[model samples]
Target: MAPRAGGLYVGKMVRFTSVGLRYAPPAGSSDPGMGQDVLSDLSFELPAGSFHWLLGPSGAGKSSLLKLMQLAQRPSRGEMEVLGVITSRARRGELPALRRRIGVVFQDFRLLPHLSAFDNIALPLRIAGRAELALRADVTEMLRWVGLEPKAESLPPELSGGEQQRIAIARAVVMRPALLLADEPTGNLDAVQSRRVLSLLQEMHRMGTTVVVATHSESLVNAYPGPALRLADGRLER
Candidate 1:
């Protein structure tokens, strides 16, 4: 179901206006060009401090949509506006500054294999030049929130799939970006673990981060019971 618009509030803090995208096959490929389009004139509005789900079958272009939001890929056509800032003609330097206000968790759990979980979570803080004392406190609190405090010093290789997923989440949210994108965050987790992970996300939303999570799990969708932007054949199905 689409989220009801009017009652939420006027002058909402986030919006996505008429976004579009496409992807080509990688080099050295024998596959014929089929004019495949990954996204088509997608438009959605996300209010600040809200949670939205992007749900669809595999290969429905959920991840592609997210990359567009993150400005990792330019749109084939149309516009995406973030916090009233239009993206179409944005400079390369402008992107990084904009991205600092966003958080992302990919399906593969992109944690550094050589770094311990604590260091991984602190990466964003360190990059932003946060002080050592503040970094330590924030990173430690994030690990504890994700129930990974005991394994804070463990490298990614030493953790199970669920633990690694938690670490990825902790890293993504450490800086508390304005927008949070989680792609199939609980895909590898069991029911109990999935709930725990979802709860962590919910806690973030309560603290006013606009969140969008893409998942195919029906049970998880129902459990959270939020509006979903359903994608089909690489386009949003209204």
Candidate 2:
């Protein structure tokens, strides 16, 4: 079915005008008062359902850009509209709702070691107060898609690094969020494993999920076919 004009189109193309971001330094750093200026005057619009890859060297602020999109942190300057909502001025009380619409995958694969694969995948739905019965079906389906059905009862420690990362991906998309941000998702995997992971991400994108993958891996960039946003010195060049 065609997406309606006014209603939400998950993973649909969205536009962003000028966007900028900065971060306050931690309590004590070399330059105590010098906060980090990550993204500067970033202006770009990511269409809904578009698959975008963020390429940059370390500390280039690619993750920071994704954080802004996820609404986990507000931009210090300019404005951003993701999933059709203005983000710079978004209220704190409104964050939970906005956050629930995003799915994030960290470079470290931040899965709860204590939770089973099933439980981990269901965490988002559970946090959003979805009914238990409904969560089970969705989580199960997501796990199956990621080829983790057999590991559904396993914990993070019991799985290989690749396996763990897939589980993290499963959890991220189990809720079918409109936006998916993956930070160095293939950083720890081998060539074959990375391809597997990227393939899964591609499948999600084809399913109408907006995907943004941030990575410094050139091999990954070559392997995955998609639009790219390159970051350098805290600015998006493309």
Candidate 3:
């Protein structure tokens, strides 16, 4: 597709037009790019049902960019449309549903320490108020998909880092979100475990979910080459 204004299409899985996000909220100033911004004058597009790598060094606004894509933070200036919703102008009450359609996997594997693996993967379904019996079977299948079926009863603290990360992936995809974002998902795993996690993410992309993975691992980038959006010193480099 040919580019539109700001080099972004009108409707995509993700779109940013002259977007800038600051260290603090826009605070009714209307022009957020004027502040000391973490991401300044960024503009790009992630097409529906496509996978892309977010490549950048540490402190290069990678995390900050993902935060915007996932609607965790609003674009302080310019426009952002994620999952078909213009999040910058979306009402506060309307964002929850949009967020539910997006999944996020973090570097720390933010599983609840108190919850068992089964419950942890089931958390999203439970939050959406699914029937208890149905959600159990779904969660169980997810555990098997991630090769963590045996750890269903294990707590996060009891599981190895690899196991915990797998559980996190399962939880992130349990709802079959339209878009998935991962922040250094393989950062804590060994080479073998990293391969496993990356495969799961690739599988998700193959199933038609738009995916973006942020990573600093050169080895990972080499192993799984794809179209990438690179950041440098708070600006898009590609």
Candidate 4:
């Protein structure tokens, strides 16, 4: 599968084959063996332009899996193909380009307090060297899409948790990356706001972006009725 213009692939956008991850023991421990595998033998394929929910309890390696998908961390062992690029085989210089094609919504709304809502959304485009004139329109439209148009000039500190989360989302998708990975995106919002955020992600999926949301909220997962990948003890359950 080759990555297309939008970061999507002709077939699977993400493919994990016997993937495994194990972190080293803190600094120095008498442990000779490798730390326990955080995730083991995890195999799955996320179809391009498809939507999925990653379900699991806390410490179930849900975050770890999402990290691998976002190219934040490579698997300790096994193969991963994201956006049709073999992660392990990709050169260091090629990573930034590969990453630009994916969008990620972190569990903790990682917003830049110094920047306004508009600037936050415009960051990606700015990094890509978009013109200032075009950035205003594109960022404003993204803020509007996330229902934060009025907060464009407001700093992250001035917004509520929900607002910050939405801003993070807008920023993530501002460039229309081909793949979107959200980690517990609704953790800070009430039921209504949660649904609204979910709907936004769904809309992105409809627009040809492959979306994967990691969450332990059963209610949230149940509402969508989409395919879900459940994890427990570092293994995936279909």
Candidate 5:
């Protein structure tokens, strides 16, 4: 079933109007191809507390769009609003706070190899200056939610791909972000693992976190259909 929004808000969480992105050349360089558009004239909105699929084939500029949404790259042209902050118009100093309200899961399962599962999940809270005792409780609850409480002291290398991904997901949401993004989250998992990961994501959406998932698997989409933003050649075709 397609995940439904929890009515957490009455408006959009993301808005892109005529957005374009071009990788700029290095200083003092004038190569003709240096500034070509990677994404052009894109417009879309992700409603607050809703779930969305970012659908497209490779080289379709999906990653570029994700980058823009994550505040990792500002659009070269047009307005881009994420979590209510229009990057082009916002001050440079305001981004970090906004970033904290967002969470991301990567396909590669970027958990720190040396850190214990508990420590990896606890890292973000530690960085945020969360009290050690309070964060311990939070991390414990996350491990329980992912059914990994027994594996807490294990390192990433000692766990299965699905477990590692779960740890990554746990880490991503440790702060309980308002917006959550997953880029090919099930790309590295088997059918069972993939379904488990998808379930966790859907649960997050149900809890009122605005979620966007970018993936190439049609079967996965068919399995859990949702509203989507389709892209082709860097444009929002739907």
Candidate 6:
């Protein structure tokens, strides 16, 4: 059954049931138990179009969990379903189509150094085979939306950290993905910049994108009233 939100049935965008993950030990590790589970028995349901904050300190498996959700890694045990598809058991051949439905913002702002902001933002649409003529207007609009219309021709290295992050965000959502996952997106920005970025994400949520952000910023999380999923020692706190 779909979960109810605001008196309406909202389907689950992501679901984890007794999920666990552990890295394999190094090739020459003397101790067989060197590798330990970074995430364990995590069970949760994120309804469609919901906004969530994934809060945890360093090494609390926040990124690991996001990786699983992004289908970059499979759970060591249990099941994970994302976008209504069983991710844990999905085949490699079927993952690309599924992954294209998700947008991810990394902590490092992984933008191409040589590409202009406008081009970077248009990369996803181009990969989806959008016509160049149509892409120009859409990309221009996204740049304006992110308040970077003037910097549309600037390369990533030419922009400030905040600007680069914003461009990265604009690129991620250019395709209007079903799910948006950001990892420590505001970690490098000041309080004000962080708020601005958060606001952009909020706008995306308002447009019906399910958003999940992994961050250690308590003040930022507190400033926004949303359900928080906290992790400690690899386990989710209720």
Model 1 per-residue lDDT tens digits across residues 1-238:
1232432222444555566676667777666644468888787788777899999999899988888877678887887776446777778788886777678988789899999999999999988889999799999999998989999899999999889988998998998787789999998888887888898888888977778999988889888899889999788899
The most accurate candidate by TM-score is 4
- Could you give the candidate ranking by TM-score, starting with the highest? 4, 6, 5, 2, 3, 1
For model 2, residues 1-238, the per-residue Cα lDDT tens digits are 2253333364434455566776787676778536867788888877777899998999888888878887778888887777666766667897788788788998789999899989999999999999998888898898888888999999999999899999999888877787888999989888777888899888889987888999998877776667899999888785
lDDT of each: 0.82, 0.82, 0.89, 0.89, 0.89, 0.90
Write the residue-wise lDDT of candidate 4 on 1-238 in tens digits: 4736633456789999999998878786878655889999998999888999999999899999999999998888999999888996688788888788789998688998899998889998998889999889889889889988988999999998888988999999998888999999999898887888888899999998999999999988778889999999899986
Candidate 6's displacement at residue 81, Å, is 0.3
Candidate 4 RMSD to the real structure = 1.9
Pairs that collide in candidate 1 are: none
TM-score of each: 0.90, 0.91, 0.91, 0.94, 0.92, 0.92
Give lDDT tens digits, candidate 6, residues 1-238.
3454443326999999999999888898888656889899999999898999999999999999999998988899999999878888888888888787788988889999989999999999999899999999999999999999999899999999899999999999988788899999999988788888999999999988899999998988879979989999899998
Q: Of 5 and 6, which scores higher on lDDT?
A: 6
- Candidate 6: where is the Cα deviation over 4 Å? 1-10, 29-34
Show where candidate 2 strays beyond 4 Å.
1-14, 27-33
TM-score of 6: 0.92
Model 3: per-residue Cα lDDT over 115-205, one tens digit each? 9999999999998999999998999999999998998999999999989999999999999888899999999999999999999999999
Whole-structure CA lDDT of model 4: 0.89
Report the alpha-carbon TM-score of model 1 versus the true structure.
Answer: 0.90
**Ten-residue segment with the worst summed lDDT in candidate 3?**
1-10
How well does model 2 score by local distance difference test? 0.82
lDDT of 5 by residue, 1-238 (tens): 1222442344678888999999998899978877889899998888888999999998888888888888888899999988767776899899887777788899998899989999999988988889999999999999999999999999999999999999999998989887899989999999999999999999999998999999989999999999998888888885
- After superposition, candidate 5 runs with Cα above 4 Å error: 1-10, 26-34
| Global CA lDDT computed for model 1 | 0.82
